[model samples]
Every structure is written in C-alpha cells, then in structure tokens.
Target: MTKPLIEITNINKSYQNGDQELRVLKDISLTIDEGEFVAIMGPSGSGKSTLMNIIGLLDKPTSGNYDLEGQEVDSLGDQELAKVRNQQIGFVFQQFFLLAKLNALQNVELPLIYAGVSPSKRRELSKQYLEKVELVERMHHLPSELSGGQKQRVAIARALVNSPAIILADEPTGALDTKTGAQIMDLLTDLNREGKTIIMVTHEPEIAAYATRQIVLRDGVITEDTRKGGEI
Candidate 1:
C-alpha cells in the first residue's frame, strides 16, 4: 500500500482558561493520502481548526503522534518543526492575511526570505507563482487596492510560492460572496487536479462538496468519513 502523505494518531489537545480546562480535541486520528482533496466540516468549537493546526505543524498536540511524509513530527524540536512547516505546508486563511503595506510580489516573497532564498531567486520564483494564479499584472498592487477576488488570488499565489506538499485552508471562502467563492473553489479544484493535496476546514456543505473526501468532526472526534466515486 502507498503510504499516506499526512498522518495523525490519537491526537489530543486542551487549553486552560483561567481556572478551567477546556478539552478542544479528544483522541482524533486521520490520514491524508497524496493528491487528495479533503474537506473537514464541523460546527463552532468542534476542533477542526485545532486538528488543522496539528497537521500543519503550526502547533503541537497535547498528546499522541503525528507523522508527515513518514517523519515522526511529535519528536521534532521547534527548529526542526519550523523547517518542516516552511518546506511542507502552505496555509490560506479566510482573512486573506496579506501584509497591507507590501505589494503582491513582496508578499509572495516572504516565504522564500524565511527559507534563505536570495533576492534574485525570490523575485523569479514569486513571479512564476503569481502568473500561475493569473496575478502577474497586479504584482505591484497592495492588498487594499485589490478587489475581494483579486486579493484572494494573491493569497493563493503566496500559498503556492513554496511548492508545498499540502495546502491547508481555514474557511477559505468565509469572507467572500457566493460568486467569488465559487471562483475560488474552482481554482482550488483545478489545483487539486494537478496533484496538490488540499485539506480545507469549512462549515458549508456546498464548499465541502468540492473535495473528493469529507470528514465530519463533532465534539473533537471524527463522526464520519465519506468519499466520492472512484475514491477509496
């Protein structure tokens, strides 16, 4: 059998709020194979975001194991985890999360800068990704200067700059209207068809329908895992 690109094993996480202990995740386990488009759906406080964070290595689980491309992530130090995050994971958030002061080119170049890529190389690569997202002409536009769709396109370019193993998007369409959201979903679907693994967290069933697989989480555990035709 082919190994999974992403794996989570009995993961658990909780937080302390003043004198209270809130259990955000309770023994969640999941696996994502290569070239798959998966969506996670849940209500508020259902721990979908927490699970996404652990998968992206943005935060450590309170307990249990996680493996990325067969590397035991739970055993990695902070620096190692940072390296993994930079090289393997690309994130897109609902809020665009662009730097207000930086133009599209510079914004997409941020990841390369952190990865020790030279200035010349950063420009070249950023331009390539910008063009892929069809935003090369708007490279000089600030986030505020772009419309909702354009800004999200720039965000997608930034997410692709690193050629990451998987794209993790949290409520990627939450901030957009229906028409714009469908356009963004089509872009994502096209990307997945070209072999990028995408795992998105969303509450809308219409958004989740774009993915080949759907996992429903409730009360911090997966309640159902469904797949489309031709999917395993």
Candidate 2:
C-alpha cells in the first residue's frame, strides 16, 4: 500500500481569548493517502477548520504530531514551516481570495513569486495551469471581469500552479450558486481523478458525496469516519 501523504497522530489545538482558554481540537488522529479525496464535515465551531489549518501548516498545534510525507512537521519553526507550506500545500477558499489588482495569470503566479522563482518561469507555469482549468483565454482578465465560476476556476488553477502534494479547500463552494458550485465540484473531482490528493471542508452532504471518504467532527473531536468503495 502507498504511504499516507498526510498524518496526524493524537493532535490537539487551542486558543486563548482574553485570558479564556478555549480548546478547539481534541486528540484527533487521521491519515490522508495520496490521491485520496476526502471531505471533513462539521457544523460551525467544530475543529474541522482548525484541522484544515494544521494540515495546511498555517497554524501550529498545541500538542501531538503532524507528519507530512514521512517527516515530522508539528515541531518545525515558523520559517521552515513557511517553506514547507510554500512548496508542499495548496489552498483554495470560499472567498476566491484573489487580488483585485491582478489578472488571473498574475494571481496564479503569486505563489511562485513568494517562492522566489524567476519571472519568466512563473509566467510559463501560471499559464500552464490556467490552461488546465480551461481558463487560457481569460488569463489576462481581472477578478472583477470573471464570473463567479470563472473566478473559482482561476482559484483552482492557482492552487494547482504550485503542484503541491495536497490541496486544502475550505468551503470552496460556499460563495457560488447551486449550478456553479456543481461545476466547481466537477472540476475538483476531475483533479482528484487525475491523482491530486484533495481534502475539503464542507457542511453539505451532497457536496461531500463527491469525495471518496468522509470524516465528521463535533465538539472539537472526530465523531465518524466513512469510506466509499469502488469509485469517487
């Protein structure tokens, strides 16, 4: 069997608000194998988002372990963690988080720029991913010029431009209408079919059905985990 691309063993996270310590995660452990699409389902205030942040390496856990592709990462310093995040994980959000000032291609190139890649290489890579999302013709279009679905497509391309080991999507369809959301999910499913490991957070069961595995979180802990056989 293939080794897991992401591993969390007995993980926990907490935050302090005005001298009040609020625990958000509790002894959670999970593994995501490469190319396996999974959905994390939880109501508001559950630890799902916190887990996603940890998996994305955006926040350090208060305790336990995170191993990414066989390396212990929960203990890495901020700088090394940033490096891992830049080169290893891609993020998609419900907000479409694009810069209003830049065109589609420019937005997709931002990660490469942060990684200190050359300008010419950035352009080539960004354009290649734009093509993958069928947005080659709209590369120069700004976020305001694109429709909701188009913008999400551009976001997907941006997430893929880095070719990271995993994609972390937080409510990716929350901002779109039903039809557009379905289209976006189709695109994500296509990406997964092509062997990109995708872990997404969603509250909609219909949306979760697109994934091969489902995990439910409640009160800062995992409550249920399910796997669908045969096909995604």
Candidate 3:
C-alpha cells in the first residue's frame, strides 16, 4: 500500500509564557493523503496556526511524531529540516508575503534561486507558474502595483514554483474582498482538482467550504473532523 503524504501522531506544542507553560496544540494526530484539499479551522488562539506551522516544518512540536512521505522528520537537524521544507512544502500567507522590491516573476523565481537552479531554468519555471496562476501578463509588476488579488496570485505562483508536495495556505483570503476571495478560492479548488495537496488554515466557513475535508480545532484540541461525504 502507498503511504500517506503526511502522517502526524500525538503532536503537542507549547510555549513558555513568563514562567508558565502555554499549550498551543494538544495531542493531535492526523494523516493527509496526496491530492486532498483540507481546511484547518478555528477561532483566534485555537492553535490552528501552530498546527499549520508544524505541518509546514516551520516549527517543531514539543512532542510528537511527524512523517513526511514515510520518513521521520522530528529527528532532522535545523539544516536538514530547512532542506526538507524548501523542497517539500510550499507556503502561502494571508499577508501575501511578496518582497516589495521584486517583481512578480522575480518573486516567484526566488525559491529556485535558493534551490540552486540555473538562472535560465529559474526564469522558465517562474514564468510557467505565473502563467499557471494567470498572472503572466503582470510578471514585471511590483507588489504595490498589483491589486490585492493579483498580489495573492503572484504569491500562489511562487508557492507553485517549487512544485512542492503540499501547499500550505494560511488565511489565504483574509487580505481580499469577498468577490476576490471567491476568485482565489476558485483557483485553489481548481488546483486541488488538478491533484495538488492543499492544506489551508481559515476561520471563515465560506472559505473552508472550498476544501473537501474540514478539521475544526478548539482550545488546542481537534473538536471535529469532517469530510464532505460525512464525519471522518
């Protein structure tokens, strides 16, 4: 049998808060298969962001096991973890974290530059992904020159440029208006249909509805896990 793309078990995260321990995630365990579109939903302080960080390899759990593509990741060193993160996970943020100075194409090309791709190949891949996000025409535009949705599209293109195993989107629609948010969600839905594994963090029910599976977190614990067909 094929292994899951991501398998996490008994994960917990905590932080030190002025001599007190503040738990952010509580004994969470979940598996995500390739091509699944999952939404992690919660109110503020629900540990959804913490969970996303752990899944994206940006933060370590206080304790737990995480296996990406069947390999244990909890044991990797900082450099190893960075390498894995760079190669395996793509990130999209609510802030659309594009560099203000870089044009859309250059921003998308940044990952390949870090990955040490040839300059020509970086340009080729970046343009391809920008086209994929339907922002090729605006490739030379800076973040400030683009609309909110266009900026997010560039962010999406950057996320796709690495061809990572999973796309981790945190409040992707938070920075846009309703109509533009819907358009972004439609793009995400279309990407999922094309076999990308998307894990999105969202507080909005309308946004979560775009995903095939919804996992609700409350007070650092998973309160509900539901699939479109039924509860899972």
Evaluate all candidate structures by whole-model CA lDDT and list the values in order.
Answer: 0.91, 0.93, 0.94
Model 1 lDDT vs. the true structure?
0.91
The superposed Cα distance between candidate 3 and the true structure at residue 177, in angstroms, equals 0.4
The C-alpha local distance difference test score for the whole of candidate 3 amounts to: 0.94
Residue 220's lDDT within candidate 3 is: 96
Candidate with better TM-score, 1 vs 3: 3
| lDDT tens per residue, model 1, 1-232 | 6469988888999999999989889998888999989999999989999898888888888998998999999788999989888888898999999999999999999999999999999999999999998889999999898988888888888888999999999999999999999999999999999999999999999999999999989999898888997434
**Candidate 1 TM-score to native:** 0.96
Q: For candidate 3, write residues 118-218 as lDDT tens digits.
A: 99999999999999989999999999999999999999999888899999999999999999999999999999999999999999999999999999999
The window of 10 residues in a row where model 3 has the poorest summed lDDT is 1-10
lDDT of 2 at 156: 92
